[model samples]
Target: MIAVSLLEEYGGIIKNYKSGDFIFEEGNRPLHYYQIISGEVKMNNYNDEGKEFIQGIFYKNQCFGEPPLFIDQMYPANAVAVIDSEIIIITKDKFLDLLKNNSEISLKIIKNLSQRLYYKSVMAAEISSQDPEHRVLRLIDYSIEQLNFKKEEAGFLINFTRQQIGDLTGLRVETVIRAIKSLEKKGDLKIINRKVYR
Candidate 1:
């Protein structure tokens, strides 16, 4: 992500959002580059039955919704604040100018996008052909490695809730609960005080 001072220099403005607020709706034209300053945001799409499939979760210092800006395409999913959040927004034109003026940040952006693409590819395959347990484990391991989940004395703490895990892995909440319990039994995971560890 671009440094805050640099974003400010490029005319970035901070905006606050309440929990459940929509940062952008699906199919909307990209107008700004958004980078989180605090709290969480999730990109998701709901099916005809109103079942949400979470595309991704982003945290502080992470940027979201850049792919559409780069391609001049409408957003494919809605971005919602998972909690009260502060975000820095830069006008699309200004953001482009910043990128043009800074090669190091541009390379970082490319690397970030590549990581996202890799995650999507891996999860797509896992969701398509893997069992619930395998899918859940893969997600936990990936998050630990890529998302920087905090480590505790017991193990690496999994920050995702069971419901979030299901949404991300395309499993039911009950399935996620059962899979976690199974994983614990198999010595692949641990549940300490209801928090999952790996």
Candidate 2:
């Protein structure tokens, strides 16, 4: 990960956003590199029916929207703050220069991107062919693997809301609810104090 001090030295500015603030909108030209200093962000899209689909969620010290910065493409989804968040924003030109000048950082970025690609591929398969419960399980497992979720004494605590889980897995919230209940009965997860753990 790139250090915040290093980013500041390279012309990055720290900005704060309120919950539900749009960091960037779909189809906008990518102009800045964004890295979270604290709090959560989600990239999402709305369908014609206004149903939301979450592309991904990122937390502290994570970078978002980098592919567009590298490829010069319009953003494919909207990035929004899931909570009040602080982010470091650097001009795309400066970010690219920073990457170019740091081979180790560039390789780390490549590895991170590759992991994201792998997640997308697995989710695509799950959404296309799996049952609702299977899809939900796969999504939860992916989160556990990719989000650095730790196993508590009870189990691995899932940080996402049911609606967020539905958005991520292409299921209706009702379906997600049913699937989670089924998963619980099967001993795959638990509802502890109204929160889910797996």
Candidate 3:
């Protein structure tokens, strides 16, 4: 498997961590590329008010630490562990070497960056829409179509707290709650044990 190959090639440098661990902090120079072998990683940024805004979430086998790969710089956002995790870290130099030697990986990196950009645009456009309830649905649609998430894991892995969702979707938390209630009322979605499903 590709996973096995990546591990065999880069496993020695990985670090194991627990929930609440800070994988990498904002403003920190990123010297490595992070590959999540298991568990979840939250990409967030904090406002001056000290409120954290969730930007992206990675599930098992997903990866981040990309801006470093491109511009040789620090990340503007924080990468945090939302669950116990194992991460394989490939140094920036090593990753650059790999990309230079392997065109396939370089192409994959380009594709990933393109996808990230698209997601950014979609989120911005959806949040800018005037309809708060539609904003919530747009957020859900963006997650399902863009992130390849199922209806069930929408609220969890997209994993925004109500406040975070409001911040991201440009809605008030109370409005988000009402919208979710509306969805439930229409039998279009269901939440049970903190999970949402259609």
Top TM-score: which candidate number?
A: 1
Q: Tens digits of per-residue lDDT for model 2 on 9-57?
A: 8899999999999999999999998999999999999999998999999
Candidate 3 structure quality by residue, lDDT tens digits, 7-103? 4475327788899999988889888878888888888887788766778877777778686657867788888898899888877777777778778
TM-scores of the candidates in the order shown: 0.99, 0.98, 0.84
Off by over 4 Å in 1: none
Error of 2 at 169 (Å): 0.6
User: Number of the top candidate by lDDT?
Assistant: 1
Error of 2 at 32 (Å): 0.7
Q: Model 2 segments beyond 4 Å from truth?
A: none
What's the lDDT for residue 153 in model 1?
100
How many pairs of residues collide in each model? Answer: 0, 0, 1
What do the candidate models score in CA lDDT, each in turn? 0.97, 0.94, 0.73
Greater lDDT among 1 and 3 belongs to 1
Clashes of 2: 0
